[model samples]
Target: MFQETPQDALVGTWTNSLGTVWAIKADGTFQVSLSKNHRVDVWGKYTVTGDEMTIQESHGSHTPKSCRGKAIYKFMRDGEMLTFTKVSDKCKLREKNILAGWKPWKG
Candidate 1:
């Protein structure tokens, strides 16, 4: 039997009901695409602490300059699906969209 590690469970692409995509790799690096064209790419680093995940944006093209700092979210997992609930206001725009809910990328 193969055991799934906490880190392993989070290493994949996730998308919202609206088609926005967010990818979290095993290396702690992440990418988020807010648009269908994939032009708005946000690059950042993430860390997992218990049930909370914190994302720190170091650089990005389309992300808000003011919301470029650290973002905190409460996460829960259901099988292969992961949901992130934004708890930090640092990334207001991100919080607004993601605060609702997101699902793991199946494809």
Candidate 2:
């Protein structure tokens, strides 16, 4: 039996410097914008244990090609800024950003 929701911290908008935006919701859904006026809507589920979180992209993008997959990440924040660092090499949404880390966004 579960008591209350988990990993509520991840439920919000996250963005990178490369114009990519991720809208993660608590209802097991996530949206990623790959470019201007272009976005990929997919399903996302996460498992949190201690300080580690695993994001599983259950469904890939609607586009023919996408970097959607499972990846392990660590959450960090500096004031209002939240970031995710890829601890696993499985996700390739943005190779450079993954290496450089992500930044939070409002839109």
Q: Which candidate is the best by TM-score?
A: 1
Pairs with backbone N, CA or C atoms under 3 Å apart (clashes), candidate 1 = none
Q: Which ten residues in a row have the lowest lDDT in candidate 1?
A: 98-107
Cα lDDT, all candidates: 0.76, 0.62
- Return the TM-score for candidate 1, rounded to 2 decimals: 0.81
Question: lDDT by residue for model 1 over 26-48, one digit each (tens)?
Answer: 89998888888765478889888
Tell me the spans in candidate 1 whose CA falls farther than 4 Å from its real position. Answer: 1-3
Q: Per-residue error at 37 for model 1, in Å? A: 1.7
Residue 21 alpha-carbon offset, candidate 1, angstroms: 0.6
Judging by lDDT against the true structure, name the best candidate: 1
True-structure RMSD for candidate 1? 2.3
